[model samples]
Target: MKNYLSSSQMTLRMFAADLLVLSSILSAAWCLSVLNVSVPKTLNSTSGSCLLIPCLFNISKEKQNILDSSPEVTWRRGSLWSLYDTDGFTIAHRQKEPVMEVVGDLRKKNCTSVMRNLTSLHSDRYYFRIQAENSGVTGTTAVHINVSESVAEPNVTVPVLREGEEVNLTCTVPAPCPSHPPNVTWAPALGGDVTQRTHLNADGTQSVSAILNFVPSVHHHELKVNCVSIHPLHREDRPLLSHKVVILNVEYPPKETWISLTGLVWLGDNVTLTCQSKANPPAVHRWFMKRAGVEEELSISHVLSFTAAHENTGEYICEAQNLCGAMNSTNLQITVLGISFTAFLSILAALSLIFALLAIAIVMIYRRYKEPIRSETNQDQNIYANMSASAVKSEQLQSKPCEDKNTCTINPVYAFKHDLPDENIYANC
Candidate 1:
């Protein structure tokens, strides 16, 4: 019995501990649910621009026991406390009664409201109050409204256009305007009014446009257009954003011209030439060959099939013209190979004839000098013959010196001729 009681006591103690943990968890969950039932705390806006302030709250339970239509939603700005009112603070569907003239929608069960057409004076802390039977359970949300004085500016875009093409001008504002709609005006670049259109947003903001529909002219290209946005609250003619310019560029004519080599052809053969021009309406190309004393216009293909000669070796002009302007090409040279070859042969023949004459002149001069050389050779032979005879006579006289002893003496007349005693030759004679 004692062991049984001890076991029972231990079981009871464990049950009590588990119950305590469950109670703590339930308390924490309840605190979290209460904390999650509050509204968002801040809101912001720009000056001179329209804004929407949202008032919303969160509820913890899904029970439908709470009436969806009885919660009251109220909004206050600065020291003023009565701007917006609704039936239910946590209900999703409730009718709204707004004290301000601004247009907005209110949701009751969700406990949220949107205020539009905000101005700079609306910059303040806004408080929301809800009336319910469970007064302490009702939630309040505080919002800080930030309003600036900078107004919305319009955007403009320009595109490259062509003649007779329709041009569109669009102007877009950055944000919606709650207080007043902006007026857009269009004036021609030169100074004239065109058709205009306007579009409105549900928030009371507006966008306007102007269009000029006419065949684009050079005059229009040089002119400018204006996009003006006038604030309704401001003075008439005084646009908050004014005088945006739009310039139009139109494509009309091709601005380039060119020509290319067709191919090579033999002498007396036919060849083709081509001329090209770039223009909007396409250009007309004319080919002219400056032959001897004539400038004949060739056909569109400009294929001159005549036998090419030296006379045809002049400038061939390709003229391209369009409605806008005309351009001419440099003269192309056409050469005839037959004429070139003939001229080369003539030069070689003249050189051969000159060389033959030079050879004949050299042969005649050699023949004319040959006879005088032969005569000089004969004279030299005679002088050698006389010297030999004198030498023979002197030898004979020297041998016979015994017969004529006195003759052996040297002779003064011939002493210079031989290195011998002068008495010998003289005595022999």
Candidate 2:
């Protein structure tokens, strides 16, 4: 009888252990069931734009075993007001009639709905409920849809250009909605469609540029070009942002032409010339000279010295240019002369000495060859003197008594002749 009691006690202990294990398993399953359900609290969306309200949920382990078929998902606002009533919100099972349409694939358990053409009236709290078999659960999410009255204005940037250069205007509309993209158009302030080309960006926001390649005239100065953007909601036809006026002031250097003193320039000469041309930006004056064989630009002051020679001559050209245009002066020919005074004086002094020597030689030759002639009366007087002396001696001996008388009569008579005749041959022989 004691042996029988021991076997019964062992069986009772095993039964008690089995009951405790079942209780613990049931307690764990109950805790998991409560954690499976969740509800969203907030919704985010931009003002004056579309909103996508997501109804996201996951089945818990406890709820997974309860349903073999898809659960019925229903969308509502506030309390029981239904937004979408269908079977699990699936595309195939969804009721054809719904308050709002669902975009993208809805079968993959993605309960996301898009509210397009949203207005201020659609702003409110929304609720999503799931019903399966005999169990029903509800989750709540708040959607704040702000419908703004005005849209953002676009930005425009114009390229810098000189007058007469082609103008390419670009308009950029940023962060635009795909459903209602901004429309871009261009118009000139001067009237007429001067735009030549256009371009668009991939995003609903666009980049539109108009190329005006025409040569700008003075009439277009200070002209304003409008890059207008129109939205589906905008009532005005004008542009959202008016770009600043671009005044193309294409300036070129001043053009000038003058008589250039180029080529071989003799010393002591000035190179004078004139320059002519037209430009937006006036050109500058720069005079340069290059020697016949040299390749460098000679300095203005240094080019032709006050003593310029033939070697100083060379080809010359003037360059005039600015941002708009360029021009050059015509080539000029230059001539230079050389002069010295010292060389002339030396030649005159030599000729004067030669003339003096010739005059003296002629005078000496004439004096040495000529002879003087005397008169015939001078020779006859000499012979008469000798005869008178001999007669006087004889008379002295014969006549002592008449000495006194004769001496008185013959008292030494002397004769003088002042004139000589060149006709007589014996004048001075």
Candidate 3:
């Protein structure tokens, strides 16, 4: 009876051991069912370059213990295949060198891998697998890789730019391989400084970005900005290059204010002055005149027009303003030409005075010449009278001695009214 009890006890113990083993097996199978891998659904890579495929996995506690002891991580091409099967080809393994390598730590459940020297032929769906002892798990989700000969264009991000304001411009490109990151450069090199960074995406791919920081100005407005990326593949061949362009719209204050004249201005002439400036959002113009060291506002519009006068002859200035700021133009001098009415009248009066003085001098000269001619005529008449008197006196003296008594009576017509000495009268005869 004791022997029979021992046999029954052995059978019961064996059944109990079998039940525990079955329960453990069931637990492990459930754990394997829950195992999941995280990776990007699609990835792009340039031919002859390198690609980095980031990966992670999660496992149950029971599976973790199993994988912790001895873990083997691998990557394969084709849909959901394992090392035991001939359905797929292995591209990366934890051990041994292949076309790709599992760079992540298998102990930490990271399944990241790097594929180097890729070509168009390497474009395919890839899978991740983890094995521990006799138990293994294969992820259902696969990563599809698309390889192309030309690199993709980089992404450029720009914000609203304002004059004198600091800003940052971002240029981003896919960085498939960290070790062989693409070289990024800026065309026209518009920034004060540039900074580069590498970051991982939620997906398996990584990205590299170049940030340019600068202060914008009106000069930069409407200018095109270019972001260029060069991906190095093989030293024997030319590298792949991609570029993107964006036009800048910079907001700024008024600048380079100036005044332009249609033609030379003269007194009482119709003239126009046009004010101009460079600015975003346009600009408002104001005209001013600096006369006698005082500035006076003229017009509040883009153009200032009026009849030019003496008051308008001074330094002219134009002011351009916007929301940002204001600027003044260099002094533009305006001169009124031609003589004034008052000055012309003054000159005419002076000329008339000169003519009057010349006429007075001519009249005085004519009066002086007439006086000399009259004096000569009077002297000649006096001399003729004296000669006639002398001839008459001689005749009288000659006849006086012979017929003194008879002549004195008869010749009353030729009477001498003055008393003359008898001796002087005789001597003259």
Candidate 4:
């Protein structure tokens, strides 16, 4: 019976201990759920920088009345889980302090504070406390801080971009110190309107944002954009710079479609015509030949090469197409002559030589015919003059009645007889 009683007692004691532990855990959880202060669980800061702890608190009606009359807020640095523990060291009070200050109004339950000159040594858990003239002091939640020596890179967000569409680009940077928040700017200034804003994050770190508004164009495609964040806390020494880059991929249709020709296009000559265009996803080229009043599709490629012929003389057009859209080039007139330029020049030269030879022959024939006629004309003129003189001499002889009619002396080569009034004589000379 004694052994059984002892065993029963031990079991009961063990159950009571378990119940006690469970009750204590429940109580602690309830207290945490009803904590008077609200603050971020974690905060980030940089060495030699400042940070703001955004906080708020609530109290019982009686304590609230007292705090509204004469409230005093305080901040301590340490890790104390119990409500009655006083092991934490005071770092800031409602009064002005060198390293920390309670910037919030205690009467309004705002316990926000600012701490400056933070270093790795300042990395720890911090707690907020509130007290009034009559109201006892009350402690609230704690926040863990992490300090680093390097600045973080800025963040850039871009959206789907298209030509001729308005867009907004957002750049955000951590703002550890509100007094001198970081400055955010964009590179290659897009000539867009920029608006700035400050935000408090749930992690107790503030951020500054810059939004750029502009209309995108084909020129901005594949362009690199930069977001630069400048920290003023490091300005006294060497300024700290953090930047992020993004390349824009803008969607556009086919543009600036045109054609280029290579090699002579005269008859029987090999020639090539090339079509070109600018567009996203590239473009497919198609060629068409327009003659008299009809249009004929010629080739379906970027280049069209063929031997020049009379049938090739016409206005050529090239069409560039992509998934976005299509565009047509201006008319490219192609005239295929009957002969090549060199052959035409050679033929012209041969014709000129033949005409020159013909002219020379004509001139020579004219000179030959003219010289003979001139000689014959000169001979006839001499004979006429001789005849007139002979007539005159014969008349004179006749007038003298041939003085000695029968005794007339006449050379064998020239002998003429003149008839007188009573005598007539005829002789050969």
Which candidate number has the best lDDT? 3
lDDT for model 3, on a 0 to 1 scale?
A: 0.80
Could you give the C-alpha RMSD of every candidate to the true structure, in order shown?
17.8, 26.0, 19.2, 14.4
Model 2: ten consecutive residues of lowest lDDT: 197-206
Q: lDDT by residue for model 4 over 210-258, one digit each (tens)?
A: 8989998898999998988878773366556789998988878899999
The Cα local distance difference test for each model comes to 0.54, 0.48, 0.80, 0.79
Order the candidate numbers by TM-score, best to worst: 3, 4, 1, 2
398 Cα displacement, candidate 3 (Å): 60
**Backbone clash total, candidate 1:** 23
Candidate 2: residue 25 Cα off by (Å)? 25
The local distance difference test score of model 2 is: 0.48
lDDT of 4 at 223: 94
Off by over 4 Å in 4: 1-27, 36-42, 58-80, 83-100, 123-144, 159-169, 190-206, 211-221, 234-236, 250-253, 260-274, 281-287, 296-314, 321-326, 332-429
Per-residue CA lDDT of model 2 for 281-396, tens digit only, reads 56544445556655455433212333455654566555555665666667654545453233344556667777888888888866655322233455566678888987887577
The predicted structure with the larger TM-score, 2 or 4, is: 4
Per-candidate clashes, comma-separated: 23, 27, 0, 2
